[model samples]
Target: MEGETKLFTREELKCRCKRDDAVLIIHNEVYDVTKFLADHPGGEEVLLEKAGQDASEPFEDVSHSSDARALMKKYKIGELVECDRVQTKNSFSPNWNNDQSQEQGKCVIG
Candidate 1:
C-alpha cells in the first residue's frame, strides 16, 4: 500500500482498450492486464470481452483458483472513484414504482 495508485473513473478505464493498452475493472478495482494477456490461463478473448466494464460477476463465475487470485495483485492499477462511475443511456432513465399495475396489488403473467 505504500505505493498505491489513485482513483480511476470508468470512462478513463474505457479509453485503454487497444491490444497494447488493455485494462479491466473487477470488483470495482482497475487492473492493467495488458502485459498479462499472453499469460492468462483463460486466454485473451475472455478478458477482451470484459475490457472497460465491470467483470466481477463473470470473473467470479469462472471460479478462479487461489493461485489465479494471487496473480491478480501483480496487475493492480487503481481503484474506481465512487462518484465518477460511467453513465449509460439507461442509467438516467426513470423507473415506474407505484404505477397502475401495482394499484390493485395484482400481478399479470404472460
Candidate 2:
C-alpha cells in the first residue's frame, strides 16, 4: 500500500480544527496544515478560520500563484471519503470573469 491514499470522514476532520491540529478541506482533498500555520503568507488566522470545513469556495476565491498551489501538495494527508465529497470549483483556474452582470451594482470608474 505504498501509494494508497487514506480517506477521512467529515467528523474526523472536524475534530482537528484546533490551532495545534488544523486540518483543511479544499477541492475534496484533506490537508494537515498545522505545521504550516506560521509559514502561511495570508496569516494563520485565514487558515484557522476555515479549519475542519470545506474551504473550496474561499480557497478558490483568491488568485493563488502556481507555486502556492504546488506547495499545498506537501501538506496533503488524504481525501474526503466518497460520501463527503462534493464537486469543487477549479482552484487552479478560477473563473473570475464568468459573470460580469453580478457586478451591476458596483460603481465602475472605468
Candidate 3:
C-alpha cells in the first residue's frame, strides 16, 4: 500500500516534457528522466525526442539488457490508466450534403 503506482493523464504528462521538466512514457509507464539526462547512455537528445509520447516500440527495439531495465526502475513515476480515449472529430472540414444545400440550382448541369 505504501508503494502504489500513481496515475496521470496524457495532457498532464505533455506539460512536463519541456527541456527543463522532462518526463518519459515508456511501455505505458511514466518515468522522470530529467535527472538522468546527463547520465543517459544514449545521450540526452534521444530521451528528448521521446518526451511526452509513448516510447514502447523504440525502447523495445533496442532490446535493453536486464541491467538497463533495472536502472530505469529508480525513475519510475506512474502507469497509464486504460480508458476509452475519445477522438475529437474535425468540425472545420466542409460536409457536403446535397439534400440540405441552400445553393440549389446554382450549378448548370447542361
Candidate 4:
C-alpha cells in the first residue's frame, strides 16, 4: 500500500468538487458529475456546486460501498481537478427506473 494513491475524505471531495466536475474512481469504476450537478434530479439544492468548504450532509444520503471507499485511495487526484466523463449515477440520476420498484434494497448495479 506504500505506493497506492491516498484517499480523499468525503469532506475533501465535497469541498473541491462542487463547482467543477469530478471523477470519483470507486472500485476502478468512475463517476463524473460536473454539468450534472445543476440539473441533478436528486434535488440540485442538496449538492454543493463549488468549494463546499464547510458543506456537509450533501453526499451522506447517497449510498456507496466501502469496497469502493477502499478503492478511492487510488484516485485522490489533486486540487479539484477534472477528467473525462465516467459512468456515474449523476448521468443516470434521472433514470432511476421504476421497472422494479418492488425490489428495493437490491443491488442496482451489476
Most TM-score-accurate candidate: 2
Q: Write the per-residue lDDT of candidate 3 for residues 1-110, one digit (tens) a residue.
A: 25877876656677786777789877557898889988988888988888876666677788889998999999988876554122113223355333323311132222
Ranking the candidates on lDDT from highest down gives: 2, 1, 3, 4
lDDT of each: 0.72, 0.79, 0.69, 0.39
* Candidate 2 local lDDT, 69-104, one digit each (tens): 999999999987776665433433355555434321
TM-scores for all candidates: the values are 0.71, 0.77, 0.70, 0.26
lDDT of 4 by residue, 19-92 (tens): 56544433222344455556555554544442333221234346535764454444435322222112333445
- Stretches of model 1 off by over 4 angstroms after superposition: 84-110
* Cα RMSD, model 3: 15.0
Better of 1 and 2 by TM-score: 2
What TM-score does prediction 1 earn? 0.71
- Model 1 residue 110 CA deviation (Å) reads 47
Q: Which residue pairs collide in model 2, if any?
A: none
Residue lDDT tens for model 1, 54-83: 777788889999999899998988877765
Q: In candidate 4, how many Å is residue 96 off?
A: 31
